[model samples]
Target: MIRVLVADDQAAVRDGFAALVDAQQTMYVVGRAATGRESVDLARRTSPDVILMDIRMPKLDGIEATRIICTDPALQRTRVLVLTTFDLDEYVYAALRAGASGFLLKDTPRAELLHAVEVIAGGEALLAPSITRRLIAEFASRRDPQHPSPQLAELTDRERDILLLVARGLSNAEIAGRLVISPLTAKSHVRNILRKLDCHDRAGLVALAYENGLISPGDQP
Candidate 1:
């Protein structure tokens, strides 16, 4: 079973998420927290496979909590799925930059919410197309052309292709269709690309792709 932790300042939200997650036979709610600090504490103790975190919390926002949880040596495998109420919330972008596996609106359908948890738990990143575009624009607008990173040269030709597609917001299945390969093969390529580029997740890959000029801003997939 995939262990999950739910964190939200509101009791009703936490309860609702817990019920939805617990109803899934493949998942179990191992813990719940109502504050950012408590979320980190529960995560450290339970070592859940995924965490549903609220972006705005008292005592420390979800972004900082996600950073701490993800950076912790003992809890490195715990993936955080940040929950927000708005699609254009800037805090969601900050959470992603802090190593959150994904972000979802609180009003997301139960099916999609469960799937988001499962996807992140399975080591896949999730970001809505609109959110991805917003993040890309935000980063692009603030990016400096001269920033240097040696991780760019580590990618092979095929991996570079996969990275470009991922940056274009293609799902694994979509990428498979585009590249004329099996979904499994596309997934493997994405994993290899992330490892080669030293990226934490697909979001990081997208940022790197744009920064390195692999895909132009005007390019559409």
Candidate 2:
């Protein structure tokens, strides 16, 4: 079963989400929190597989809570899915930087929300190609080209190419077809890149691609 925790300052939204998740036979809500700090505490206690976190909360913010949970060695298996009001906005990006596995808009369809939880729980980051492009565009101009991450040196030519494909929002199957390799090979390369860069998921890789100057704003995917 996929263990989940719901965190939002609003009681109605929090309870509603918990109810929705509990309705699924494949998943269950382990806890609910009205504040970010409570979310963090509950997470340590429950050790849930996924957390649906609101970006804004009292006593602390979801982004900071996500950071704290993700960085904790004991909670390494926990993945955070940020809830936002906008698509591909600054808050979502900040949450991703803080090690969130993915994000969804607050008004996302119920089916999609459940699917997103499953995907992140299964260790895949949910970033559609279109959303990835917009995320890159949203922060391209503000990127500090002069201070690229030194971790770029850890990747080889093939890995660099793969990273660019990931930044373009290509799936492992798509990348395999594009590069004339098996899907498993593509998946392996992606995993290697994630390990080399110390990233939590594909979302982090997309962020790193831009932050390390691999993919720039206005660059065609």
Candidate 3:
């Protein structure tokens, strides 16, 4: 089962999320916390598979909590899916930088929310398309204009191609179709890219791609 810990300051939100998570046979709500400190404590104690963290909580905020949880050696495998009410909340970016696996709006559809939990738990990161575009734009604005990292030199030619497609937000299957490779191969290349680049997931890949000018903001794949 995919164990989940819901951390939100509001009781109603926590209860609602717990109910939704519990309804899924593949998922279970392991614990709930109404404050960032409690969330951290529960995460350390339960070692849940995933954490649904709220950005704004009393005592401590989600970004800091996420940083602490994700950086903990014992909880390295615990993925944090940040929950926010605003699509472009500043804390969302901060949480991502702090190693959150992904961010989801509190109002996300039940199906999508469930899928997100599954995706992150499966060692993948997901971003809503609109949010992804915004992230690209923000990254573009903040890019340092430095030359690409030496790590890019370590990627094979095919892996480089796959990285570009990933930065463009194409899934492994889409990349497979475009490159005429099997989906498993495409997925493997993506994993290799992440390891070589020392990136966390697709979002980190996208950030690195834009920051290094591998994919331009005006260029749509």
lDDT of each: 0.83, 0.86, 0.84
Please list the residue runs of candidate 2 whose C-alpha ends up more than 4 Å from where it truly belongs after superposition.
217-221
Error of 1 at 10 (Å): 1.8
Ten contiguous residues minimizing lDDT sum, candidate 3: 124-133
Residue 34 miss distance in model 3 (angstroms): 2.5
| Distance from true location, Cα of 91 in model 1, Å | 1.9
Q: Which regions of candidate 3 are displaced past 4 Å?
A: 147-150
Candidate 1 lDDT, 162-183, residue by residue in tens:
8888888888999999989999
Question: lDDT (0-100) at residue 53 of candidate 1?
Answer: 95
Per-residue lDDT tens digits for candidate 2, residues 1-221, read 99999999999999999999999999999999999999999999999999999998999999899899988989989999988888868877888878888778889899989998988898854455466556655775577778877788889999999999988778888889999999999999999998898887788888877776777666664
User: Could you tell which candidate, 2 or 3, scores higher by lDDT?
Assistant: 2
How close to the true structure is residue 149 of candidate 1, measured as C-alpha lDDT? 58
Best by lDDT: 2
TM-score of 1: 0.84
Alpha carbon lDDT at 132, candidate 2: 50
Q: Provide the global lDDT of candidate 3 against the true structure.
A: 0.84
Best by TM-score: 2
